[model samples]
Target: MTRARLKLNTKQIRARQRAGAVRGLHKAVNHLHERSTAVAPIEETTLINSAVASVDEGALRAAVSYDTVYAVRQHEELTWRHDPGRQAKYLEGPLVEESAMMLELIRAQIRRSLR
Candidate 1:
């Protein structure tokens, strides 16, 4: 009979877990940005192209935004007319509709990173 024991460092394990989580968060944010862009109102493609995803590592938070002068107005104005398949609240709609999938994306990335 043979017996073997292996010792693992808890600190290293924790760091690895945190890194995995952060990677997941980044992926999640990018996922949101992508989905939002797909449904975003496209006027000369300015708003769609201006989309950006930002993650704050220390705060463990992320945001997807469109950097345009009229971005807010375009997102909020329900009365304004857009193309047949487009309308106001483009980002908000996607954020709500894709919430579940986004979370899954984060979880999957975390698992992958851990491995």
Candidate 2:
């Protein structure tokens, strides 16, 4: 393939990979929901718990911690010449912390229900 075509192909592949990763995460989330609700086989509950436990804590934190609504004012303050590195560090870190806490709450609820 030509150089330009190769770059285009790479971009397409990256996009597809991103979409597939998102779909997998969604499926995992849905599986947890189903298992918690007892909509699936009992054996699947173990699988769902395992899957949720296996999610990388760092990645989960990174995904949810960057809430625009909560951080809008902070973002605006630094916008004249924003540092992407600093922004990522500031905005993403706390979001990740909140996500971790929420995940723990969900896990606790699941545990309580199983009792």
Quick one: best lDDT, which candidate? 1
Task: Please give the lDDT score at residue 62 for candidate 2.
Answer: 16
Candidate 2 local lDDT, residue 19: 50
Predicted model with the maximum TM-score = 1
lDDT of 2 by residue, 5-113 (tens): 4335667565555554544544444444333323211232342233221344336321222223334454335444432333323333433444555455555544443
* Location of the lowest summed lDDT over 10 successive residues in candidate 1: 106-115
Q: What is the C-alpha lDDT profile of model 1 across 17-63, one tens digit per residue?
A: 77877888888888899888887788799899899999988877899
The parts of candidate 2 lying over 4 Å away from their true place are 1-8, 39-115
RMSD of 2: 19.2
Q: lDDT for each of the candidates?
A: 0.86, 0.38
TM-score of 1: 0.84
